[model samples]
Target: MKPPVLLTRDKFRESVFARDNHLCVLCGAPADDAHHIIERRLFQAPQEKGGYFVDNGASVCEPCHLRCEQTVVSCEEVRDACGIKRIVLPEHLYADQPYTKWGDPILANGQRIRGELFFDESVQKVLKQGKVLDLYTDLIRFPRTYHLPWSPGMNDDDKMMQSLAAFEGEEVVITTKWDGRNTTIYPDGRLHARSPDGRPHHSQAMVKSEAARFSFDIPPGWRVCGEDLYAKHSIAYDNLPSFFLGFQIWNERNECLSWDDTLEWFELLEINPVDVIWRGTFDEKTIRALPLPNPEGWEGYVLRLARSFSYGDYPRAVGKYVRADHNKLGVVHNWRTAKVTPNQLAEKS
Candidate 1:
């Protein structure tokens, strides 16, 4: 199946391309190619009651895919660095066989990333290595972001850094951002997750075991990627299903919905999802003027599109404004509170 698209050669790539609006999953890269999901994957259509495998069957390109295989720090080190309390997977995602190779991950920039695609004892052992974790805080400094280890070890700061707009200060309304690695749990009762780089994130064995507990039929036509909040992202530790956050929701066509519609869907699921700030109409300056009311973090905002603006490829589409007072790096942590700024004070008055 040699198609013009980057990952179109593989059927799985076809699935993902059909799913991701042809955009790269990592760094929100526009879809360029197919990334092998080296671990748990199935050649057959997914069924709700049956089990699947770990993400051992998919494929990736280079560099970015490698991040999932291991972090800048080792797994154990990352685990320890983030101070995670537990890891949970019911075990239906994988068959008795192991997955190895994980292959190279596809990047936003057309670069190839590598990961643990092959499921071997060596891979298992490699993944088992120590990760230095810091469970108490999420506000890590730049370069400091990778110091801990695994993606799960990331705290509120890490959470804010990736999902929200830039942080401006204490007035930011920081809510308990949900914790779940970016994933798209399919509505067909299938669970397809991904790493940050647009590579496949399968843990099918866990999906089968964990899925049964939920009352809602995992939506058959939708895939929502958000942090699966467990002990890692919580002040207290727990891996309960109810705790997962449903962030970006995509249709089967890989078309994204408006932020408002997303919120409504979560409501349908009976789950409360956190989001970037929602304010009445304001210009870029006004949005910049408002206090960054987050519990604490900012990757930049996943700005919700108003219904007027919501349409094809709208949820993933965003336009945001930020404060000029940010530090030298333009990093959120470096950004200062606008309360001291003139616009904010004037607005309050």
Candidate 2:
């Protein structure tokens, strides 16, 4: 809510020390200050707690700090062993892809989901063709700027403001706004199902219902996928209309969808998606030691494994979502649809 004073290098070190238990995130060297590898920036904690505190800041050791400098050093190079991975900035995530029709859309012939998915001709074609891969590559090659979509729920409305307040000065990485019905591009490309809430269940049906009404021009090799929200809520949460919300193209390394690729998919699909609450490499201790403004509705932050090194698909990525629900980030709501309590109205009058 309040702006932070830029921390001096010494101040920055102090803050890092305060937050990091005086140990580097990488090596156990007593931290001199916070070392931000992304820009080689450093910040010290204020004598109090009201100074420049970039959300992206992370505590680093001498070795890890040296690797970030543009100047190449041999021994320091090892610190580069596992640099903090950067997320795609919102602008960078959605620059636009070269339009090219790759092939026919893969439909679900027959699918089975025991533990893994089994695809029929409908699904096989998707797997063999790797249409999802092409679409992914194209979107990643260039994505468009993203805008988040809001709903009636308190999840985004309440938690976003908390992250914003606590990490305002920190480096905030914004990714593309994904648009499309919630669709999952199954690695097999055969088995798919839509979630009841419009999230992609699996790469499955294109339910033609009230919530989902679209033309038939599906991008080749891909399915216009997502959940049957209308169906789920309308019928019995098991059948009926579909209220699709998100989309994902089949990736060769479906199990290992990288952060970069995930960004592009969200862009190309044009669906509303969750965002990076806070980031910039740090271990549990350093993160825990750091002091942040406690706020209501705070979900704290999320830590996702680097995209390149990811080992699972969406809904199952090596991502850890954490946050504190307090008075930190205020709830961001669509004031228009927000309710007016009778007590409040009476007070106003």
Candidate 3:
């Protein structure tokens, strides 16, 4: 057999990007990087192992690049996107692999970013050590509640209030904002707590395992965003319907679902959603005077437009009003270090 040609990393990336038309197949955004479907570090020889070939790469945007690394955007999906068949690895490539170069920096959007490097002793030990990638950087967050008072002289408050005012008299959906970690569950069942790194925290261990139990067949680019209520944070709940309560769902186009649609899908998945506190036309007076559920344990409520909106329109579409002193006085102990406490669940017939 003749020896195949080898390509440098730069040449490999360029060839992969060129093959995909310089566009992210996952989201159709401007492609700035090419990613390996299999771990590049697993390749003992680029020429012999075929690691540097375009068939093993996918052109992606920076955000989608992170998704590829996280496995939320599956290797199969990347292969389908690139119009290639799955790259079957030889057993020798991964079997009995040595921990050679884990936690190495990843190239994305033409820059090196923090890799998926974590301790082996923790719950994150399941993660492989070699060829790490950074956490997703563009994950959406719950918009700040405009009805609640922003600190005085806060630069963005005026603009936020203006956006909120535009929705006056529009129908809105108000849901219980549980005092827990804001978590995102991908179609592949990966859970990420809202944080700078978006890693599944130790406190969220139980919920992460539970979420992974469900086979979510959502569309390739869709995501389920919700609150993981496994551990008590600001308020210790006496009863929790489920450890996870979905609030919003984002489609492949990055557009959020309407409240009615969100509820229906949550039902379809057998996943409980946050309690709907109220649903009616926006009336500041009615909203302010409404009594909160469980005045002692409830965190507060979130107000959002009943209709769907694009990802970028979040600032104008959602808001929340937390109880007084919730941030400072509500949380008395660190949920991570404290002993694992189980919240009571309502009995099902």
Candidate 4:
């Protein structure tokens, strides 16, 4: 007899990878194999149903796939190794099974849908152990406020004055705006960039080393957000005091501490805060006349309110002012070329 067609293979694999952003759910690397979390052979039918379902699959790298297959590690261990809470399964699988791993229950054909589907104690145990640090959940995007030009026909000085209007009566602290890649430090000492595209950042080791240097504690579900200033972006920060500078501290709820509190935490951890430009509220004329923070004309300044604000809500508490004629050098054909080499200065010559 002719072999039964393997119709579900490619489609199921693609769907899993797509859901996982083509990265191994275990290590966040490029996935090459679709792992069956529940071995296909364990299902009742050999050729027909449960084996090909998407709920039982995970997109994994070669090494991780091997580890899953050899039984060297449990499925929960594999998920925790990468901080993945639960692998999302295809919605359709719940139709027949009524329940699947990582999903809520569905009512069978004639039964009334009475109570809500819930994870049993065993399932809850697995889920609690597999807490994943999701990108937005663990690492928050540092908010940026724009510089408002004075008016349609106003001069540069007038524009600067206009931008400072919002902070006229508020206590404001200004700091130099460093050009760098955004990074975050998790409570478990893991470091990651703010990228959603699955592209890896080169500063993981650097961040870890710097984090180790600090003696302070970060409570669970909190993270330290900073600027990874090792490389040159639009403007080269050649005189930067350090490779990384702590700018904000966020709790599990994604609320950012106010400027003063953030600085206090930075001091406690011995982490360098961004260079301060000015403190205290400034009059429009004073703001207009203030000198640029850097003689070389760095990007701009960040104005922050001195007190802490509620988490996850936008605050009119912070703003930035970028130099109109800031350096736009170092444009490259590809971003990989922007990495600062050890001998970048020598090579430039």
Best of the two (1, 2) by TM-score = 1
The alpha-carbon lDDT assigned to residue 203 of candidate 2 equals: 21
Better of 1 and 2 by lDDT: 1
Top candidate, metric lDDT: 3
Among the numbered candidates, top TM-score falls to 3
Write down the lDDT that model 1 would get. 0.35
Q: Candidate 3: deviation at residue 57, Å?
A: 36
Candidates in order, TM-scores: namely 0.34, 0.28, 0.56, 0.51
Error of 4 at 123 (Å): 25
Q: Which stretches of candidate 4 lie over 4 Å from their true place?
A: 1-136, 150-168, 195-198, 311-315, 337-339, 342-349
Tens-digit per-residue lDDT, 1-349, candidate 1: 2212222235545554555556544445454544434333222112211112212112223443455454332222323322323321112222322222232233344333222222245554544542312111111100111111112233333311222222222122212333234444544444444533333322233433443344245454445555443322212223233435566565533345655677787776665466656544434445544455542333334343343221211212333332222222222231123121111111222
Tens digits of per-residue lDDT for model 3, 104-199: 222233222222222223213323321333342333333334444432222322222344564687899988878878877777776676432334
TM-score of 4: 0.51
Better of 2 and 3 by lDDT: 3
Expressed as tens digits, the lDDT of each residue in 1-349 for candidate 4 is 3432333877778776776788988778899987766544333223434456554567889887766654344555655554444443332222223332322222233221111111234433443444421101233334324353421222233312223444668776778776666777766676666522235656445666777676237778677878776666666644555678887887655567888788888887777888777787655566556787574535666666666654312224555666655534554436664564421222233
Q: After superposition, how far is residue 11 of candidate 1 from its true place, in Å?
A: 36
